[model samples]
Target: MTFDAYDTWWWPYLFVLVAGWLASDIWRFIGVAIGGRLDEKSEGLVLARAVATALVAAVIGKLIVFPSGAVAETSLLVRIAAAAFGFGAYLASGKRVIAGIVVSEAILLTSMQLA
Candidate 1:
């Protein structure tokens, strides 16, 4: 039977439930079923890691170079300095993600306040 979401309030919920399952859950189930067979040191996995790292670096570069809202108001030198300090903190903290992010944000906010 065909469901019309516009005709009933409950139909929208049903539609979303079914559509969401088909859109995401199916892929998740497929991944779970097949993912176990993949080797940890496979070339594909290595490439995936490299691509993910590149994407993250690209995003960080974008944020530093083209910030928005209040961050955009800060000078380029301040942003670069903040990023440098954060990177240093990350290295100093044994490559901790939280340390890098917190130090970066603290530097940015403090610079903003001072400027």
Candidate 2:
């Protein structure tokens, strides 16, 4: 009478699919529905964008300052240098996200090899 997800192989996959949809895709659908009515230059949208950008920056800062796993193996100087070069690449590449990521990853990989 009791359902045990672990008792069946397909149940775990079904649970994961349902959980993933609820966790992420549902938010996307909601955002699309509500965002469709908002003006591109609305104050609400601008504030939301600013908040999102700040959250990303804070996360990046945390990773650099209090790194864990493989990244923690590198010296603080290496991390900072990589971030600086990545920012410069971002700016020089007309603010392209891919440019920043590629430059930062390359710097980190090279530094890790050298260290």
Candidate 3:
């Protein structure tokens, strides 16, 4: 019955957040510092590239299939159409990601209104 009474759950949540941040960010900072000493075309870089690609794919797949907001409320077909429109724009505009994103968002908004 009080703001300061988070009780048993608070410590675990705090610990997880702090630990996750430290685990991820510490190595990320070290990577930046050690980047100049590392080879761009190394095996480690290749593994990192693969992991990054997989994560990106997972995020995009989630967005197109199982979003978690107003976007989640929209139909899959609508989302796909919007994405396709945006991608087409990107291709037409010399692969400019920002332009593609803007056009795609506009398409999604207009389609949602029409629906």
For all predicted structures, in order, the TM-scores are 0.66, 0.62, 0.74
**Candidate 3, superposed: residue stretches over 4 Å from native:** 1-19, 32-36
lDDT of model 1 at position 37: 71
Best by TM-score: 3
* Candidate 3 local lDDT, 1-115, one digit each (tens): 3434466768666766676677789988998887767787999889999998998999998879888878877889988988889999999999899989999899889878987
Better of 1 and 2 by TM-score: 1
Model 1, 31-92: lDDT tens digits are 89886576879998899799989989999899999988878999999899989999999999
- Cα displacement (angstroms), candidate 2, residue 4, comes to 22
lDDT of 3: 0.84
Per-residue lDDT of 56 in model 3: 92
Clashes of each: 0, 0, 0
When 1 and 3 are scored with lDDT, the better candidate is 1
Which order, best to worst by TM-score? 3, 1, 2
Alpha-carbon RMSD, candidate 3: 5.0
Residue pairs in steric clash, candidate 2?
none
Locate the minimum summed-lDDT window of 10 residues in model 1. 1-10
